[model samples]
Target: MSMPEPKTAWRLLKSAGVKYVRFVIVDIFGRPRVDILPIDEAKDAFIDGVLFDGSSIPAYGGVNRSDFVAMPDLDSVYIETWNGGKTALIFTSVMDGSRPSLRDPRNVLKSALETVKARGYKPLLGVELEFFLVKGDPPMYADGGVYFDGHLLHTWPVLEEIMEHFHLSGIGSTKTHHEVAPGQYEVNIPAGDPLEVADKVLAFKILAKSVAQRHGYTATFMPKPFWGINGSGAHVHLSLWRDGENLFASVKEPREELKYAVAGILQNAIANSVFVAPTVNSYKRLVPHHEAPTRIVWGLGNRSAMVRVPYYGGRINRLEYRHPDPSMNPYVAFASIVFSAYMGVEKRLEPPPPVDTVAYELEGVRETPRHLGDAVKYAQESALLPEEFVKPYLALKEEEWLSYLKSEGDWEKTWNKITRWEYNAYLVNV
Candidate 1:
């Protein structure tokens, strides 16, 4: 079922044992924020929206200054994990009085989805997010179990509780499995409406990690916790449907539209990477092998390709893009996806000749940009994406990168000091 409308959603929250509502929003740096309120304040928040200093949030300051509103998306109201009986969390939409805040990442995505509906297509967007389970206060890699190593593994035995929590919170994930690393695992939700998919991601991250901690361990969504092994992926699965028919599929032997969309994404790959794999740590995961697509190539069933139109279901099926890690703000990620796909629709774009041959060995195809600095530059230079996303997004990230750069030690030395994944996986290669 589609989530309830806001008014009814508000009614349900009032009726529940819900005492305090936390207005949850993600800063431009992908960190979630909360503005807590007592039950008495809920009605005012539900109707008028709560105000805060816009200049304080990363990537949010205006030329002079502006006060922003945090309007609760009431349907997003749910019991926050790890909270005592008094607290509940609700995802928020950024706004200014009656006007929705254009600088808000969530609102930016909502605007993009409006375009999707206007274009007359129902977009099916899904994600498979992977992360690692650890035991330290700071969280460290724990196991060496290859993918699907059952419950016999370490303190990572809380899948049932995690699944149940997701179900009760109204964001049900479709699948959970042990991943290739010892403590790593993945949870997947089936594709549906684009906005809902983004909501599920927001709810899942805060809650899932909270649940993991409840079992006396921490879960890190940091891409690539261990080196040399498979790094984590938020591999995005995309497809199009019009009045109950998949639109990206090929009818006979090949399709032109799929080719166009693939080309468009490749053409925008550098800009897209800034949003998809946002963190400096994220680049460590987007390496040459272990299913990371560092090169801009496409092929059938090849995990290494950035775009894969796998030949699983027959003519004119969906294609999966093997980029995007778990750290992205889902709102921004899905919004850019629809925008890229929209370009495909606009230009009748198509993927390059199916590299039926292996993509790793493919000669002329371009390679994905090398680092976060490179990705940031690409985002600045691209005229294809909405200019709104470009400037604010980069400003947000540059601020974050500057902060991360200020650690006690130097970049060359402390780079791996914070992460052992490179040493564990690619030390020899380096």
Candidate 2:
């Protein structure tokens, strides 16, 4: 069903009775916050927005900050899956009352989307979300099947329940299944314009978790809750479409199609990595042994490559960047991918030929993997991010990085491996 536009959000408030119409938006770390207003106050929030102090949230505005507005974006508005009688869920963009904050993650994504559109192609993003389902508040799924296991059929009942709700909500889900990690699962959603897809992502997560909760279970999209076992990743596959044509389609250059897209993604991938994998825990999922992308390389059907064209090919055909976990803010992450792809297209960057051979066994590229610092440097120095960002990106995560550094064993995170240290401590810690 078509959603009511922002201009009409106020109409919904005026035309219908709403028991609750609160605005929900995520902070820098992808944590959701709500500005709950009585149904009566929501009318003003649609246009004038609900006024709130910006100093309350962590890793956000300064304590002595000025005013910020939660201008509702009805375009992003979604109804929570289990609405009782009077309340509904919607998302908003935090504006400076004059203009949206460029520092705001949502605005950062919008800026990138605008840039890509101006470049002549509309970017389409498809995300393959892999997460786990547990039985309790922390939640666990019914099976222990690992890595493309077929036990998904066992959970079909639960999957069917969730998918039915999504279909009714006009958010189409492409597929769902068991992942490699025990009890881990994945859901693939249909592709759409970046903003629209991001909206679905917000809805998907809420519904996914809520449905699981209702069934006496719990769900987590966190990147690395298990630490050593396989961590979840929201690996996104992207391609450009203009006037109903796939810009990344290999049809025209077939051989070159694969290489060109790969080169472009790698060139801009590092800078965009900031958006794709934003949190400190995100780095923990980047190790080579964990099926994570550690190097700047691409290959066909190789789980280890940073970029891979999954076996399913066509105009809907595209490259999948497997590095991003669920920790990223959907808006920023999607835009970042589009920006990188635009840079790739404009520069006509040619990827090193597809690693027809195994990428792990391939020679010449650096053997050790790249770290988050390596990626931060790339994005920080990139003309794209530097030009559009509101401030030095370094100032963005300094505190979080330093905080993680203070932990006893986490300090050597960048250049060291966790398991390596554990092996060295074996039986000698007495």
- What's each prediction's clash count? 12, 10
Candidate 2, superposed: residue stretches over 4 Å from native = 1-7, 10-18, 58-60, 135-142, 147-158, 251-259, 311-316, 366-378, 386-393, 410-430
In model 2, residue pairs whose N, Cα or C atoms come closer than 3 Å (at least 3 residues apart or on different chains), thus clashing, are: 133-140, 133-141, 134-139, 134-140, 135-139, 135-140, 139-218, 147-180, 271-379, 314-317
What overall lDDT goes with each candidate model? 0.71, 0.66
Prediction 1 TM-score vs. true: 0.88
For TM-score, the strongest prediction is 1
Query: TM-scores of all models?
Result: 0.88, 0.84
> What's the lDDT of the predicted structure labeled candidate 1?
0.71
Give a tens-digit lDDT track for model 1, residues 1-430. 5667656666676677677887887676456778888877766777767778877786666647767778777656667544544567788888766777666778877888788778787778888888777776445566666677765445545677777777766676577888877777889866877777777776777776777777876667777666667777888888877788777777545466567777777777877888888876777677665778877877777677898776765555777888888877777777787778768876887666666655666676787766666778787877344566568878766765565555433445544334543333221110
lDDT of 2 by residue, 336-388 (tens): 67777677677777777556555665567743225445556655666355343
